[model samples]
Target chain A: MSIPARTTEVIGILGGMGPAATADFYAKLVSITPGASDQDHLRTVIWSDPTIPDRTEALLGKGPDPTPWLLDGGRVLREAGATVIAIPCNTAHAFVPRIADHVGLPIVHMIGEVARYLTSLSPRIHTVGLLATAGTVRAGLYQEWLGRSGIHLVLPDNASQDHEVMTAIRKVKAGTRDDTTTALLTRAARRLTARGAQAVIAGCTEIPLGLSADAVDVPLVDPALILARALVSRAGADRTAR
Target chain B: MSIPARTTEVIGILGGMGPAATADFYAKLVSITPGASDQDHLRTVIWSDPTIPDRTEALLGKGPDPTPWLLDGGRVLREAGATVIAIPCNTAHAFVPRIADHVGLPIVHMIGEVARYLTSLSPRIHTVGLLATAGTVRAGLYQEWLGRSGIHLVLPDNASQDHEVMTAIRKVKAGTRDDTTTALLTRAARRLTARGAQAVIAGCTEIPLGLSADAVDVPLVDPALILARALVSRAGADRTAR
Candidate 1:
């Protein structure tokens, strides 16, 4: 219609490592935005290519790497006028570095934001438990980030990782979020708490779908939610900076 | 890495009439999809520009024309490689004709799909009530489509449409989906049922956020959900056709 005014920031979601998780992340981003009406919310472009190969399989060296797919998605967002990018999947973060330079837009690092979020907590958190895909654990994504902040990271054992964590993630991907899914996550989380974890991190985006904070004794920290908050904050900063 | 197997279909969402409703529509699309894994879902590009001027205001002759904004969003989706466009907002359909030819993508008609869906119901619906924005109501979107099927469409009276229906839609866009919103919508539906409507259409995308099907005596038909199903069906047909 009229000459377009410059948008302060346009959030590009490079998602669909899992379709449901991507949808959840976008919904959370919309929810946490401090707007009263549709006009007050941020501009968002979501490119959800579910055909992207599984990140966990790639990280485990059993499948083709997803780096090329991530790079292509990033370029798609850039061409669509995205000022910044946000990847909602945790395991996919392992490949972010490989594609970040080629994407042509700054990506809001989800795991890095989680590390900073933990450091800013009112009550200091020391030992944190993680419930994530084997790929994330194998990549040491949380270990590397949290280790920098002096926070200890606890993880499920090999058996639990194979049976409980991975199975629960599979169930969520299959669109099942029943009590059994919650029980698998809860059993895995309980084991971590017994090892002295003060708060549990739902490192994998699928983890939060089946498990809630009250299900575990410790505060359930959701990295996806943290990523959403970080994006909202980034959008606001971009608006003011402009 | 490997060549993207010819994507059977790519869905473009022309949205951001309000952010939450757009998010809700995507979530519903994901939920209804028959696939158990991420790869089973369709490729989607969502361009949610919340800055798109008010559709209702334009239809009411009190605001700037939104056709330019709609056309711009359609172009963004097309450039991003979307094959077909799905608009989540009911009111925005009022301007679909103005921009459809120019958008260069097959726009899935949400209201037309809703009319077809109602016709397909087993018991067969004769009379349907509509809960939508004043813009969609004034545009006669449901009236024109449903009339072709020989279906009777009942509408909220001027007083009820202003006080109950429009207010409820506004509350949802403002991010308030409380019991009060439900109450307002429920009251509106009850009046329509008393007037001999068999089912009520949650024609506005925002209405489903506050009002569920069980809240009213008649089935609360959600055009957004129906649109999601239609998109999924289209994707499948495209896959087979290829």
Candidate 2:
């Protein structure tokens, strides 16, 4: 199929890993795009099927495989004319390679984008703390991506991950955001910063919704935000290439 | 073309009349749906083409017609297997009849839903104020819908509409939210309440984003939230009917 000439690329978002996180990523996409009028923004299609099996549970061998559902969502996006695909959930990235192989679309890598963004910042930060789901940690998704760049990764201790970070993520998914969640996340961030981490990656999509930059002592990097920017730049580059 | 038997309806959102509002509506849809896991939520296809012409400007005769783009969006949704369609923007509903004619899909009527929701409230609001764009006010969209139900519609005064409501709506479109904007909206809500309006409708999608129920003394009804609920109910009904 011959793609039509357009000023912006059609971005296909394979989302709904958790409905709220997908919505948060989209809100950031809208906010960050510099557009005074409607036409200035990118053409986008979102396939939000919340039916995909939980990535974290699947990663931990506690649930069904999510690969089929991820592939199905990617197919939906591809059929919808998405020139590029982006998955907002960090844990879902574990299935990207398999999905990409099936769907045949370039996915803007979320972790890679965060690594690039962190390195781009002034002072050339190296050590970063990760506050993410246990699945993402066990899968070594970020570790694999950042290792090639010689960046050090600091993770929440197992207890902190199991009790604090994990609890906060579930609360957010259940639509609970209060001082308790904030305090739990803050303590986790402090532990990371005290471990000599220059910055913290709110690696889980739900984390950014509850934990803001001000809440952490170190810079709290949002992978979803980084991925959104990367998608925009990729779309712009596509326009220029055409 | 026969749709296969499914438990959920495929929701087609024709969005991007100011992208943030579309994101807000989608977020509400996600939250309102009763789902414990990823697969429990509805399958949604959002075509966010911000290139559509400005609805308010078209309604007010200040800009080009948005009907073509609206039709195009509707057709895209219809082609994508959307059994029912929804337009999140209030002003965009002005062109729905024409778009529905073109796409032949039933659009969940936003204003009609608001009218239904208002009547469903206890104590049964008879008089309601609307804080919306000048185009929506002048177009008499709500007045026409509420008129059939014998519900009286109060509006912001001419000066307040121009200076406060319109300015606040524009500020929201530009992604500006601050004390000044909040004050403007709060003052407008007070003016409506002062006119004996039992409740105020945040008729414009942008209004609910900046002016929440707590911002005003009188009950502030968010039309977007109402529409989201209406769409969900409609989708659920579709499943049962099938």
Highest lDDT: which candidate? Answer: 1
Question: How does model 2 score by TM-score?
Answer: 0.92
Q: What's the C-alpha lDDT at position B58 in model 2?
A: 89
Cα lDDT, model 2, residue B230? 79
Model 1, A1-242: lDDT tens per residue? 24253347889999997989999999998888766677788888999988889999999999888888788889889998899999999999999889988899999999999999999997999999999999999999999999999999999999999999999999999887789999999999999999999999999999999998899988999998988888878776323321
| TM-scores, chain A, per candidate | 0.95, 0.94
* Shift in Å, residue B22, candidate 2: 0.7
Model 2 interface CAPRI class: medium
What tier of docking accuracy does candidate 1 attain? medium
Instruction: Rate residue B233 of model 1 by lDDT.
Output: 84
Worst 10 residues of 1 chain B by lDDT: B233-242
By summed lDDT, the worst window of 10 consecutive residues in model 2 chain B runs over B1-10
- Writing each residue's lDDT as its tens digit, candidate 1 over B181-218 gives 99999999999999999999998999999998889988
Per-residue CA lDDT of model 2 for A1-242, tens digit only, reads 22223454888888887888898899989888765555667778898877677889999999988887777778778777788899999999988777767888888989889878887888888899999999999999999988878889999999999999999988787776688888889999899999999999999999988888998777899999999888877767323331
How much lDDT does each candidate structure score? 0.89, 0.83
Candidate 2 residue runs with Cα over 4 Å from true position: A1-6, A237-242, B1-6, B237-242
Alpha-carbon runs more than 4 Å astray in model 1 = A1-7, A237-242, B237-242
